[model samples]
Target: MEEVEVVVAHSERATLRVGEVFLKVDADQSRIDVEVEAMSLAPVPTPKVLWRKPPVLAIAALPGATLGRLGGPSTGSPAAWAAAGAAIRKLHDAPLPPRTGRAGRSIVALAAELDAECEALVANGVLPGDLVTRNRQVAEAALRPWTPVFTHGDLQIAHVFVDAGEVTGIIDWSEAGRGDALYDLATFTLGHEEHLDDVIGGYGTDLDLDLDVIHGWWSLRSLLAVRWLIEHGFDPFAPGCEVDVLRARM
Candidate 1:
């Protein structure tokens, strides 16, 4: 008998794996809708959808292992990271999706949210005031204007699959849509700062991508994520995780 695997479970959604098929159960049908649509539209490789039944979306497992998770060692080679970067650039250059993605927040909205979260973090004693203040300063650069592009808003390393130093697939498109291109780049390189050059190499230098903006996204994402991750029973303070990412900026 094939053993079922509990991939992830939290308040908003849960994912399970049964042999070769992975089933994602989300409370929001709209997110599933976006995932299905974005996969069809994305130019790069994505998981093949097997079926969908309201809350449960079944997809075939991809051929390779993920690049790695946050707070963990990344197994992908320099070539693999670059390949992932190249794929992301292709997605960014694609036509825009109709809806706002996870990374699509306007500067005003994002700044407001960041401010609120920072206050809460300090008030609740979740993080030191100095840490939050410094990161907040670093995050300011990302609040500027940006042209929207197709983005896999939550492009974590673990979501990218690779084999033989090549990108095989990208998964978890629930956050995909029109958004800032730098947001995707920042998300992909968040905890793996050492690999930034490899990704940039694959992504190209002609685009004039700003390193400061990417770093700003890193701080912004870490600050905004700490609360939700805590609520979701995840430890943001884990080594090489969100808190550490912020601490490095200090």
Candidate 2:
């Protein structure tokens, strides 16, 4: 019998692993379309799409261990992180996909949303008012203009697979789209700030990125994610978690 393992289950979506196949179910069909198209368009290695039917998309699981877990230090070597960086650069440098991706949210448009989220966090006591305020201020730097690039929208550490110091594959492309290039960099390096240099080293010196904007994204992303995580039964307040990331900015 093939045992079905729940990779993650939340209100918006769920991912199940049965043997070597991963089944993703989502209420939103458009998001699934984005995932399929992004996987097909990305220049970097991605899981093979076994099949797709409406709410269900099945993909063969890629080999090797994840780069790291959220809220934890990554065990991936500097070489592996560099390889991941190189892969991201390739994706960013690739020609834009024929269709726009889901990450089309503009920073200017997100300001109101970020303000509301921060206020809710303060009112709900999800984080210290001062901490939230400071981080919100820092996050403003990321609201400036940026040239859109092909981005993996949700480039969490765990989504990147590495084996023997090489990035074997990158999974989860639902948010892939034309967006700020630094946003991908920020998302990839979220809790793993210590390895930023290694990633940049592998990315090379061709492009000049603003470190302040990157730092701003760290604050912004951590702040906006807290309330949503709580509503979805996640504990972002745990040690070394999103709350800690915000507090670190103080």
lDDT of 1 at 73: 97
Error of 2 at 60 (Å): 0.1
Q: Summarize candidate 2's per-residue lDDT along 1-250 as a digit string, tens digits.
A: 9999999999999999999999999999888888889888898889999999979999999999988877886889999999988988999999887665544577666899899999998898778889988999999999998888898899999999999878888999988888888899888998888989888888776897888988999999899898889899899888778888888899
Q: How high is each candidate's TM-score? A: 0.99, 0.96
Which residue pairs in candidate 2 collide? none
Candidate 2 Cα outliers beyond 4 Å, as residue runs = 99-103
- RMSD of every candidate to native, in Å, equals 0.7, 1.2
Please give, for residues 84-144, the per-residue lDDT of candidate 1 as tens digits: 9899999999989888898898889999999999999999999999999999999999999
Alpha carbon deviation, residue 58, candidate 1 (Å): 0.2
**CA shift at 191, candidate 1, in angstroms?**
0.9
Q: Candidates' lDDT values, in order?
A: 0.94, 0.88
Task: Name the lDDT value of residue 206 in candidate 1.
Answer: 84
